[model samples]
Target: MLANPATALELDHVSRHFDGRAVLSDISLSIPAGKITCLLGQSGCGKSTLLRIISGVDRPDPGGRVLVGGTEVAGPGRFVEPEDRRIGFMFQDYALFPHLSVADNLAFGLRHLSRPERRERVAKVVERIGLGHLLDRYPHSLSGGEQQRVALARALAPRPSILLMDEPFSNLDQGLRERVRRETVDILRETGTTAIMVTHDPQEALAVGDMIVLMRAGRIEQVGTPFEIYDRPCSAYAAEFMGPCNRLTGLWSQGRIETPIGAFRADLDMPDGALALACIRPQALSIGPDGQGISARVMAKTFTGESEQIDIMVHPLAQTLRMHSHVRIPMGIGDKVSLQLNGAQVHVFPEEPGTDDPLDQS
Candidate 1:
C-alpha cells in the first residue's frame, strides 16, 4: 500500500440520501496528494454521489466529515459552498456554455484576476489541452474531444487544489476515449494535481488511475493498485467484477480442493470437507485431453485473432468455465479437453449461507 501522510482529501464516515433513499453509506477514504484515484462501480452505486460530496456539490450527513488540506469542509451542521471549496469538477456532459466561445468559457471563473492575468491563464490552458486553434469557436462547432478539452481547461483555469471527474471519457468513442484519457492522465500528472474520477469502466480505471477503488451498493468494497487488485482480489465479487473469472464451488480435502474439475492445491486454510468457492482467472487455465484431468466438453469458442475464448462445460460443477488462450487449439464442438489449472495462488472463499453444500458429490 502506498501510504502518504499528506492527504489532499479525506472522507470520514460519509453518507448521503435522496428523498429517503440512501445513496452513499458510511464511505471513508483518504486521497493522497498528487495521485490519481479512480472510483469504479456500476451506475447508481454512489460513486458519483461521493464525488459530489467531496466537491461540495452535495452535502453529507452531519455525522460524517469532509476534509481538504487538513481542514474540515463539511461536518456537524457546517458546510462550505462548492465555489469556495477550491475543487474543480469536470461533469459527464462536458457542461460547456453553448453561448460562450471557448475562450470565454475557459475564462468564466477568472473574474477575480486582471484581464492580462485571465488571458494568460486561458492561453496557457488552451495550449495545454490542445485547443488553441478552437478558442474562438462555439461549443456546437467544436468536436466532442475538443469540447471535452475545453471543459477540462475551464476547470483547470483557476488552479484548483483538487479535481473531480465524473465519467469524462464516457462521451467519446472507444478508441478516442482511450487516447483522450491517456492524455488527460499525463496532463494531470504533469500538473501534479490531486484528482478523483468516477468511472464504471474497469479497464479505464486500471489503465489511468494510480489507485483503483471498487465500490458495490453504496460502499467501497476494496481499494488497491491495478496489479494488486487483478492478481489478488480480496473477494469473489471483486475478482469477477474487475474481469472474467471462473468461480467453482468445491470442498477442501487433504491440502487440496476437490472440485468437479479435479483436486487442486491452494494457499488457504480450509478444514477437511469444508465447503469453499475457488476463483480462477481465465489466463491461468490450460486444456489438453480430459482423461488426464476433469472431463469437460467444449461448449463454445470465439476467436479474436490474438486470442481465442474457449468455453468448456464443467457439468455438475459449474454452468461453464471460460478460458482464453493465445494458440488456437485444434478442437471442435462436443470435444472433451483435459483441464490444467496453473497460477501463483487461487482465491478460495467460504460458502455463503443457504447455498448448496459443496461436499455433496451426488
Candidate 2:
C-alpha cells in the first residue's frame, strides 16, 4: 500500500488575476491534514482556479503564498513545478492515456524507480485498489465507473502527499455517481489521504467533505462543517445557496421578528422598528388542521415522489408560502389549513437596501 503521510495545506492571501480582472480575491484558508476539503461554488466562481493554484498548475498573483506540510511551494520569490510538488490530480474527465493499459497507466509516474521497483509498486497499488483483473484493459474498454476507479488508483499509486479532484464524478450517471462517490470517499478515508475536491453540487460537498469552503464571485462566502454551513449560514446569499428558502419581510421588535406567519424569536442588534428579513426553509413549515396554528388556504400542491410541496396563501401575506412534507397532504385547492413554523430553522437578517420585497413580485 502507498505509505506517504497526508499533508496539511495553507493558502495565505492567495489571489489570482486574468486580464487584470480579479478572479480570486485575498483567499486565506488552512486545510487540515488527512481530511477532505471541498471547494464548492457555481461555475466561474474561481473554485477550479484555486484548485489549479494549489496543484501548482497555475500561479497566484504577487503577495500570495501556497504551502503544503508547512513548506512553501509557491510565493513571490520562489516557485515549485507541478511534478515536484508531490501532488496527484484526478481530472473531471479521468484523463487516462487511450493507448496505455491500466497497468501501464498506474506505472507512468513511477519512471523514477528501477524496473523491479516499478513493477513492485504497480503490483501493490493494483492489489490495494482491486484492479489486478483489469490491468491489461485499455481506457476505452472500461466503463465510466471502472475508468473512474482506474483514475483514482492511478492517482493514489504515486502515494501523493495531497490529492486534488476536479468534479471527479460529474460524468457518471446519477445512480452510478452516488455509488462511485461513496466508494471514493471510503478509499480516501481508509488511506488517510488529504484531498481537496472542487464541485458545484452542494449535496455532493455536504455528503463527502469534512470541511466546505463556499465561494462566490471570486471571494470566500463561508467556510464551515456541512451542518454549520447549512443550518447557520452567515449571509442570506449563503443560506439560499445551500437550499430553497422562503424569504419573508418583517419588522424587528424586542428580540423577535414579526411577520405575516407569526412572531419568531430572533436575537439581533437592530432597533425595534428596523426592517428584517426572515428566511425559512420549506421543510421548516408544518401543515396541520385548521385552528391549530396560523390559518391559511391551500393554493397548490406538487407531488415530488418522496415529498409533497404545498403552497398556501396565509391570510395576512400577499404571496403564497411553500412548505415541503414527506407525508401526503390531503388538502385540495382552497382548503383551509394551518401552518406552524419551526423556530430552529427560521433565520433573520437585517434587510438591506435593494433587497427584494417578498410581497412585490410585480
Worst 10 residues of 2 by lDDT: 353-362
**Candidate 1 lDDT, 8-75, residue by residue in tens:** 98899999988988888999998989899999987778898898889888889779999888888899
Compute each candidate's TM-score over C-alphas.
Answer: 0.91, 0.94
What is the per-residue lDDT of model 2 for residues 167-221, given as tens digits with 9 covering 90 to 100? 9999999999999999999999999999999988888999999999999879999
Clashes of 2: 0
Output the number of the lDDT-best candidate: 2
- Model 2 misplacement above 4 A: 1-7, 354-362
